[model samples]
Target: MYQLLKQIVTTGIVTEPAPHADSALRQLEQRLSETILKHLGRALAIRHVDAGSCNGCELEIHATNSPYYNLEALGIKFVASPRHADLLLVTGPVSRNMEQALRRTYDATPEPKLVVAIGDCGCTGGVFGESYASCGRVANVIPVDVAVPGCPPPPTAIMQGILTAISARRS
Candidate 1:
């Protein structure tokens, strides 16, 4: 045990330096925080709805909340109830089963709400447009203020869409 401790003490601290922050990303986050406070007068609360996804977009969405992105630091958070949300982030195509639920959620949201359609499935229904089980795009079901199109958009894209929606609200 003494020899092991001696060996450990002999090895100096060896670790990589912390990664540099992206200036563009920091600017975006700062702008979003300022905009939300200016236009909405409070922190932005979002409700994420998965109509019928293969969980791809959800993964990207989750990444936005990680420490590196720190979405909460910019006064943005996800809520469980639509009633408490200022923005609705919807992903995936509107499936038959989730149509009514999505409508109800939209209806429950307060006035002057922002809705962002995430991913190709949520934007244009991807390859599952207007089918028996899928209802095409999110706009076909509920009005979308911003649409981020990708099979599973990156966290930055999702953040941009949210910012766009907030900007639209300002307008």
Candidate 2:
């Protein structure tokens, strides 16, 4: 224990320094926060609906909430219920079983709600397309304000999609 303590004291703080912040991201964060506050007068509430995804987009969404992206700090938050949501972030191709639920969630959200469809699956249905078991894209079930297309778009793209949706609503 004494030897371990001595080694620890000798090594002390060997981790690399944190990376510098991206100016573009800072600008986006500022714009998002200001837009939400200006239009909604408070933080933006989002409801995420996973219509039958492979979970890749979900991973990117999770990354946006991490300390690096810090979505909550930008005045964007995920809510458990659609009733409390100002926007819907839907992912994946709509499965037959989830189509009705997605529609219901959209209906439950208050008026002037924005929907940002994430991934190619949610946008054009990706490799899934329209099938008896799958309903194809999210737009086939509910109105979509913005579609961020990528197999699994990066966190920055997802943030941009949200920003676009909110900004469009302002117009």
Candidate 3:
């Protein structure tokens, strides 16, 4: 016990240093907040749908909601129901089974809604193209306002896609 305490004392606090505040990211957050307010006049409510994915894009989306990206600070938040969402953030290749559900979700969202297709799968269907079991890209199932193409796009890219969708809506 004495030796263990001595070793702990010697090791002290061994941890990664806190991340530094990023001015660029802060600016982006501010811009997104303002743009969302201008276009929607309220916080952007998003509904995330996973048609059929290997979960890679979902992880990046989760990271976007984390403190580093601080998506909520940008006045964007995920909601449980499509009825309350201003945007639909769809991920993965559209599977045959989810086609009806995806369509229904899109239909449920009110007018002036936006859709951002995340990852290459959502954009171009990735490895699962149009097939008996797959419906190819998200656009195959529903209209997509913005397509963010990447095997699994980073959080910043996701944010950019959302911003693009909002900006395009005004024009």
Candidate 4:
């Protein structure tokens, strides 16, 4: 135990440096903050729907909520109900079983809502493409304002997609 303490003392504080203020994430957060204020005039509530994902995209989305990303600080947050959401983040390719549900979710969201298709499966249907059970891209069933393409897009890219959807609402 004494040796461990000595080693700890020698090592000192070993922690990752704090992210730079001008980093891409910080920049995106700043833009989101401004857009939320100017466009929505309040916090942006996001509702994430998984049509038929393998959970890869969900994992990446989860990363955005970490301290490094600080999604809540940008006034953008995930919600459980579509009724309370200002934006919808849909993941994975649309499946036959989930197609109706996804449509209902879209319909439930109030007018002036924005939709962002996340991941390659959501954007282009990926390897699944259109099949007997798969409905292809998100736009195939409902309107999509922005599409973030990646098998499981990085959190930063996902953040950018959210920003892009918000910016589109402004124009």
Candidate 5:
């Protein structure tokens, strides 16, 4: 049971429920939403790197930007270089070839930055665990702050991951 709760974890790994659905919590949620909107007012600049994916996961990451689930509403935007990014969005199994690049990206991002590993392959190595060419997971290369799982999670879920990270820091 201890390992089950501590070592073994599901999809995202962390969750927090609002204290209530009543008036005060509702009001607080509204305030939180507004504050998050304000803090995230400027689109969160992000840098995305593919460690060694089969591309199935990358497809889903791209879908987050499609018209329907558009991540822009949360004021998140993908940037090119890690230096300018507030978040590092990593995907795929950790490939030996890209190991250095992943570290370089993480190094380039300034302090207080986050790494959101998207997909089970990126998080726990998923189907590609312990391969000759893979390090297995993203955390093996770079420390992960938040993990958004699925083969590739929906854009809304990605947003939730970001929000949760922000909320945890604030609290």
Candidate 6:
């Protein structure tokens, strides 16, 4: 009875997160937006690669463009070819079978391209690091410009990482 009452009251009274906190997030997003516009005026085309993930991180990565977040508003887009990619968003721990593929993918992208390794697995191998078939993290194959650490980092975090990379380039 008491538990039910508490649940009802909490649900009734608790609103969204703090308004100021939401404002802070908005400011961060604006900062990223301004940075992208200032440094990379052109729309950024991203190519995604999965070395050997369970696909958890991939879902969140894909969600960046969907309606809830709508990363396209930030002038971001996904491309099919690595050659045309302005940035590479790589997920999962490197696998023995995928080592060459990973290298080939990275090589296909033109120089001055940024690499974003997402998820704890992509960053540091997570649970799959100890496997004999695993080749450690994404860094084991190519240099990564940004690291978004989480079991599966939120789309906002991934966006920030990409925006940061874009801002680093003067051209």
lDDT, candidates in the order shown: 0.77, 0.79, 0.78, 0.79, 0.70, 0.75
Arrange candidates, best TM-score first: 4, 2, 3, 1, 6, 5
Candidate 3 lDDT tens digits, 50-118? 999889999999988776677777677999999999889999999999999999999999876778889
How good is model 4 by TM-score? 0.77
Those runs of model 5 whose alpha carbons end farther than 4 Å from true positions after fitting are 1-42, 169-171
Deviation from native of the Cα of residue 138 in model 2, angstroms: 0.7
Compared with the true structure, what per-residue lDDT tens digits does model 6 show for residues 3-91? 99998777664222211112211212232345544555368889999999889998998878666667776677889999998788889
Clashing pairs in 6: none
Candidates in order: C-alpha RMSD to true structure: 7.5, 6.9, 7.6, 6.6, 14.4, 9.3
TM-score of 1: 0.76
Of candidates 5 and 4, the better by lDDT:
4
Q: Candidate 4 residues 1-171, lDDT tens each? A: 999999879976533322222122221222344444466634789999999988999999998887667777777899999999988899999999999999999999997677888999998899899999999998899988778888899887888877666652232
TM-score of 5: 0.73
Please give each candidate's TM-score: 0.76, 0.76, 0.76, 0.77, 0.73, 0.74
Task: Estimate, for each residue in 1-171, the C-alpha lDDT of model 2 and write its tens digit.
Answer: 999999979977533322232333211222345444467534789999999899999999998887667777667899999999988999999999998899999999997677889999998899989999999998888878778888899887888877666652233
Q: Look at candidate 6 and tell me the lDDT of residue 46.
A: 91
lDDT of 5 at 138: 87
CA deviation > 4 Å runs, candidate 2: 1-37, 168-171
Q: What would the per-residue lDDT of candidate 5 be over residues 1-171, giving only the tens digit for each residue?
A: 976776555433333322111121110122234455456446677788998888877787786777565666557788878898877888898899899989988998986576778788987899889777899888888877677777777656666665554452232
Summed backbone clashes in each candidate are: 0, 0, 0, 0, 0, 0
Model 3 regions lying over 4 Å from their true place: 1-37, 168-171
Model 5: lDDT equals 0.70
Ten-residue segment with the worst summed lDDT in candidate 5? 19-28
